[model samples]
Target chain A: MSDSRVSSVIQEWAYSSQAHTQTLNPTTTNHAGSTSQLTQMDMIPYSQSQGLVRGGTDDRVTEQMMGLSYLPYTSSSCLSNSSSTGTTNHHQGHPNTQQDFSSFLLPSLRAPVNKRSISKDSAEYRLRRERNNIAVRKSRDKARRRILLTQQRAQHLQEENQKLQMRIGQLTQELDTLKHILSQRHLHGAEEGVAGESNI
Target chain B: MSDSRVSSVIQEWAYSSQAHTQTLNPTTTNHAGSTSQLTQMDMIPYSQSQGLVRGGTDDRVTEQMMGLSYLPYTSSSCLSNSSSTGTTNHHQGHPNTQQDFSSFLLPSLRAPVNKRSISKDSAEYRLRRERNNIAVRKSRDKARRRILLTQQRAQHLQEENQKLQMRIGQLTQELDTLKHILSQRHLHGAEEGVAGESNI
Candidate 1:
């Protein structure tokens, strides 16, 4: 295809993809959404169109939306006209560009439902940056969990130490009493021996 | 004082302490009726002698008598002969020997009530050892407590993370729904726009 023709095709695809994204954004707001209405409407047609666009699910749409927002475009409305058009010719007919586009959209499509978020592709530089933010948040949560566990263990040990000390004190007191009785018994025996000597 | 003098003093004290101790023994199985009564009366004189020898109370006399069993003697009956001979010029004065005597007698005087059984000393030793053991136990308890707390905190964080995930999912769904509605509205607008243009 001619360069101009390829550019037009790319623009048309991008616009349709954007439109589809707008349609899906509300559904992906919650992982548990009633997509039965849309799903029931026409499964085949929707899936077919889904196959055409890189991001078929609403989650992907949000990821991509956030990804798009991170782009250098100061104005959200003018992104396609300025940046999209400028980068169009460079990616045309490039295998790497196609791969990048697929990578950018596939993660959002297949990301764990609980942790749904965008992953960036080489070409989807704007989306890739957004994915980094999510990764950072996950690590911080893990560290906080570790610190909390450490503190609890310390408190438990202190309580146990105190109980053991009380037990030792009680044992010492009993020992002392036993020793006292033994001494008194010895003295009585001595007196009897002396009295026997006096009788002799 | 000289070593021999110290030894003699210790021996004399031990011998005297031992004689008085036999008179005070409570577990005499002697069936001699008059001898038993005489033995009991003799204990008061013996006690006074012990008080003169060490210048201490009955409690101290008892403490020393109990300490004797841990020594080499079999019976308190040998105390009379042992006293005069033990205190001869043999041990006149030695600080180390004196210290030894002091240590042996100190417990009885200082802790008179502790003369229950050999367990009294053992209990004291055990208490010391236990105190050390508690230090170790405390550390372990601390570690365990820390782990429990960590687990609890992690559970709390997990709950929060789950809630946030749920919220994110809901927001995604809402966004998707909104986008779907917008698309329907826009599609309707586009259809109306086309009809109007065709008429014009």
Candidate 2:
């Protein structure tokens, strides 16, 4: 909600658009049925990276708030909460540590933590990831809603069309029946007139 | 573009929405603050595990494709291209050998990879993600245009309102002037009549 966050989100959005334009342009020009994912995966890292950066800043702010609260109030409840969180983090961190170790199985992972630790970038990267994830959710909801609305509109139109067709068919049948009756009456009157003239 | 990818993307989208709704739901007994990345970090291990599975699949596909193209029926140019790609990949594969590892890094490398490695899921996710980004852009643009149009309309309305107020004021002034002139004429006529009567 911070101005900085909004600014960063906007900045990242611009970057994302440029990335999309670049990827789509290549697909159109080469006629290579390039997988949309290929372009997407290629572009996502930047967005993710941006998100991570933003997230880190947000995290820092949270940390600062926690730090400030810790300083002034010295509330026993707050301390207890922090301690409980620390303990919980420790418990959860274990599984993640095991998983992180496994990531090193990749040749890329052979490079020591000092070299490849996205840790420095992790804060911002994490933020961006979270933001992108949120944005992704929003868009998905929007799309689903759009699709649903479109389907509904189509159904309404179809119903209207069917009703119109039925009305036209009914009118046509009525017109035919009226014409037949009129013709028959006209013929019968002609015959009567002819017979009357003969009688005269 | 595969049906599977689409479905999973839909699932991912659904899951994300569920998560967001869960987060936003005020009625729910369960409340989680935006502060804790602890839950997110816990999920990271699962994501990493998923990433490993995906990496294996990608390697398997790449290798299988490489093997398939090994036959003589595959053109020399195609074979050469594959060989070059393989060599390039192999060379690129070594972490220590590369001076510019950043260039070699896939967007996936820096980001979290989900366990569901299907292109279908990713394609759908990417589609959703791109769509979301586009939607954000579109909504923002719409809002901006709306603001500008509203401002223009307001200015016009304000101008119109001012002109009307001025016209009302002018009419009031004219009425007042006409009343004063009529009253003065009446007074003069009354005085003249009185004077004439007195003279008679």
Candidate 3:
């Protein structure tokens, strides 16, 4: 398959996983909750194991080449295909073409291949899921912290506003008292002048 | 008058001035906005001047001793009474008591004493009112600044919240892609395994 097709497949897988996580925790997904449209394709046991081996190896090489180090786990096929590709490469130099044919049957000759591969694929899937879950949790925690900090700052600002209002009140009261004293003195002076004039 | 009565008078003057300030700016008086019930008392001119002189000096001394440096200006009577009291004291110690008495008579002796005193009182009132107006404007400006700051901070917090929400969406999408890839590989492996079994 072309590189673009492989990347598109991986992108589809990530989208599916995000949907699964949302289904697991519906409450938290209220903000950007959207139903995943990707359907689950059923697979036969043997093809599932083989596909796991091929896709895992291909995804890992593609991710590494693309420098996507954040995706910690390689594709499921990487572990199985790497040794097989190495063996095939080594056998390519052999003159005995019949040995190479026998080598191609080696996987079938192993009685426990299906069970072992299936178990391995299951384990890898579980590990990748765990890592994705951790990343989601971390992002959520960070968002929550930011919200809390902002709320605290808003509360502090409100308190400061109230205190300033109180200060204005005190100053207003002081100014009024000063004005009253001045007016009182003026009135008193006027009255005394009138009395003095009447006596004269 | 007793020291207590003098202090009471000063206190009443302070309270009256505070009431006047409240009346001038009715909007900001959230705490003591009730109408002042303190009645204006009539007084002889000599006593009015004496009270002004005493109250002015006492209030300054009290405010200084109390460390109330924020109150920049003294009681209203201070400016007018300070000059009058100085003239009275200088005349009191003169050997020509009769001449000093004539000088005291000079204010009452003048036909325009009432008009001149009224003009002087008006000028002082105008100056005091101007100062009060400036203080009110300053207080209002400070309140406006505080309100503006709070609104800006609230806007900033909302923007931050939006950015964080966007980040969460991005992270969710990334996580979903990773899950989809893992599931796809598992399904592919199963299909290959079933095909192998059917061939066997």
In candidate 1, stretches whose alpha carbon ends up further than 4 angstroms from where it belongs are A1-200, B1-128
Tell me the tens digit of each residue's lDDT in model 3 across A1-200: 12232333332223323221111111222111111111111111223322222333222111112121112121111111111111111001111111213223344332232333422124454354345544554443333233333334455444454555555555555545545654565576567556555655
Worst 10 residues of 3 chain A by lDDT: A85-94
Interface DockQ of each model: 0.01, 0.01, 0.01
lDDT (Cα, 0-100) at B37 in candidate 1: 24
Which CAPRI level is candidate 2? incorrect
Evaluate residue A124 in candidate 1 and report its C-alpha lDDT on the 0 to 100 scale: 54
Go through the candidates in order and give the C-alpha RMSD of each one to the true structure. Answer: 48.6, 29.7, 49.3
Q: What is the lDDT of residue A110 in candidate 1?
A: 29
Residues B1-200 of candidate 1: C-alpha lDDT, one tens digit per residue: 12232333444344334331212221111212212222222343322432223332232222112111112111111111111211112111122222223345654332233234323124454454445544654453343333333334433444445455555556556555655655565576567556655654
Model 3: per-residue Cα lDDT over B16-50, one tens digit each: 23221111111212111111111011111223322
User: Ten-residue segment with the worst summed lDDT in candidate 3 chain B?
Assistant: B85-94
Estimated TM-score for each candidate: 0.20, 0.26, 0.21
Model 2 per-residue lDDT tens digits across residues B91-150: 011112213333344553321233354232245544554456446544533433332233
Tens digits of per-residue lDDT for model 2, A46-145: 2332222233222211111111111211111110101111111000001111212323345432323333433312455445544564566445444333
Judge candidate 2 against the unseen true structure and give its global Cα lDDT, from 0 to 1: 0.30
For model 3 the local lDDT of residue A194 reads 64
Q: For model 1 chain A, where is the 10-residue window of minimal lDDT?
A: A73-82
